[model samples]
Target: MESWGNSTTVTEFVLLGLSRNPQVRAGLFVIFLVMYLIAVAGNSLIVVLIVVDSHLHTPMYFFLSNLSFIDVCYVTTSVPQMLVHSFTERPTISYGRCFGQMSIAVCLAETEFLLLAVMAYDRLVAICNPLRYSLIMNGKVCIILALGLWTFPVLLTLVTFLTLQVNMCGHNVVNHFKCEVQAVLKLACSSTRINGIIMVLASSFTLLFPFIFILVTYGRIGFAVLRIRSAQGRGKALSTCGSHLAVVGIFYGTALAMYLRPQAKRFTNREKVMAIFYGVITPMLNPMIYSMRNREVKGALWRVIGRKVGK
Candidate 1:
């Protein structure tokens, strides 16, 4: 079936992007480019510090390194193209590339959600079962978890492709800057009920379930903190969990808002803006939050810097 308003099978799509005005586009280009650069550098530094510092060889840092890596990959998949499109006239993307972006971006994002849940569990074990933490989160298990985090996204890509049928009508103008899944799907001439259903299920599994897990895990952690007799001990315990909680709050808040919204009709421009904020803004902010709130990470970073100076 051909698209209702369009006649040709869409081979490529023209992204209308955020602005049509040259001045505004140029300003946005500069802003997003700077944000992308900061995000890459910040997350890259976190991964490096985690890998190089022996003191950070614990499970928490290991998971954090993976999270940083995913953040870098996630920002790269989406932001660079947006920057390019901001400058170019009538920015367009091929059908294949659009899905390619969607695959990589979604995979990275969902994997982060899973990773965060695992991190929450790690925190739980560290706090609640401090004596048995080592035995419980052993080297072998960490390796398996890392491998699973890396591998599941690939499987998700395949499942997403096979299950969803999207036949785009001739309407090839994508509303957002990049080839977002929702926006691209809107071009489809055929019914998207099945796609919506699958996305809802996938969203529940990837986003909702993990979110609930984090809440419950943290709730227990909060109670565990309160049980400590000394105020200093309680403070230390809460501080340990603070940075992760902050990061989770920002990442999940924007993401849940973006993905969980109804897709029955075309999304508003405000929704598009929210997508850009989370896709670009969150990555840049995560490193800052960790550095400011996490003392150990700061120490590792300073030690790394000192080593460079000494050498």
Candidate 2:
């Protein structure tokens, strides 16, 4: 009887997606559908172009291809579920699947954190020590970095695991588009101190640490460029850093506001909006950011198109 009682409680959760209004929901469905399609296609194209174009197969493109692939997975992990809930009147998800989404999201977010850091280090080596760049970020080193990106995130899985311990008491409604961490934790009747602490600690490691590393790398790159005598060389170096800084600003700004600022104890409508900004908008724009900022990417894209047209 005790086991059954515990099991039956909160069998599933209802996600009160973006809106209840028919017009708003219809509009949102189309919007997210378009965003998803573009994000996948754009990122996949980046990956494929890098692989096929021998000139593009450097450490930077390797990391970029990995980033593109992760963007596909990260967006897929959340957007499809949101799309499903948009049209359905109920917008419900089972308990297992809800937590499952949380776990996957954590994994992807952590992986991106480390991958971005490795990319920063790659840039640091490239700009600050151009002659030794190949020796430092060789194929073997890059592979190890990629492997660690995927493997070292088990520490974050504990957040969702701890979430399972919270007692939902059979009431099944989550007031957001997806199974966001803080939102789901709100449903629990028991103490959530551990979960909250885990969130903060995890956020600090994944967000703060990588951010600090990137800043230090840029600092080094700045000093290195100042030593260059040619004006054109300095401009080229600054431009590369500018593109990466833009991505970092968008990603960290929204993500920190959404997760870290939730210290107020509840996930609010504002946080949902912030989530949409980082979760959907940022990923969609990443490819454009890279391609538009870097001339090489644009040239490679045209070459690929030209090859296809020639055939």
Candidate 3:
């Protein structure tokens, strides 16, 4: 507890990270540190490829770049801190810093949810309405969509963050490694009926609706792919949409399971393990998923490598 003038509040939180065993902590640290570095490097490579390769300057790559950027940021928000806390005997975070971390996590999550939906739409346009793909998803339109992806999530997160700033009554021991909003909310001593309502609403908007939108958009894309007369055309269409769908499945599946499920009073080890899926594992997998399965991305990478070697 800390005092401000005459009032006392929780100024810091002691984080009970993943393991208490020093050997276990050391092992987890090495594995996660390797993952974190791979995630950052992989995502950064995609961004660089997209920027330098003019042929890849379309709506799909634009959104892919955005996704990569988000994954990089998303993992950075929690993983580094988690890594630090993992090995520490008494890992702690300041109250203000915890709030900031929670807020950023919320914003990035909401943004990625909406962004994935937008990517599905872009694929739908390219495959379903090929003739009008350029006209329908013009640069101006893509820019507008990108702006909305970044802006709207921040606004929504702000509302959720504000509602979460309730009286915690000096309960400052965080069960999980990171400052997850829901985990933090459990510490609040004040009536959290409004906060719960707001959380449900926010989750519905950010997680539920966007997930449904992606599914429906893919449904339409599936139909359009079937209509293609050429087997090669159909295969190409599937290839284009497949990587995005894979990412969507891993991301949305873990996210929905974590956020929309019935709330638990205590943050279980199972929940802590679940948090690693979306927070750490997903980002690491994303760039590899996109690059390995994507021919154009691979070609762009080789081209860049060839140029460097030639120079």
Best by TM-score: 3
User: How would you encode candidate 3's per-residue C-alpha lDDT over 47-118 as one tens digit per residue?
Assistant: 999999998999999999999999999999988997888767899998878878888888998999999999
Instruction: Give each model's whole-structure lDDT.
Output: 0.84, 0.81, 0.87
Candidate 3 or 1, higher lDDT? 3
Per-prediction TM-score: 0.94, 0.93, 0.96
RMSD of each: 2.6, 2.5, 2.3
Q: Model 2, range 1-311, lDDT digits (tens) per residue? A: 12212556777889988889989998999999999999999999899889988888999999999988988998998899888778798888887888778888878877887888888888889888899999999999999999888787765566446544566776677878988878887877777777677678788888888988988888888898899899999898788777777778888788877777646565678889988877888789888887556788888889999999999
| Candidate 1 lDDT over residue span 1-311, tens digit each | 44322334777889989889999999988998899999999999999988899988999889988988888998899788888888788898887788778888888888999998999999999989989999999999999998997788678766876678666657888888888878878877788888888887787878899999999999999999888898987887787788788888888888888778777578568878878766888888878876546779889889989999999
What clash count goes with each model? Answer: 1, 1, 0
Model 1 score (lDDT): 0.84
Off by over 4 Å in 2: 1-7, 158-164
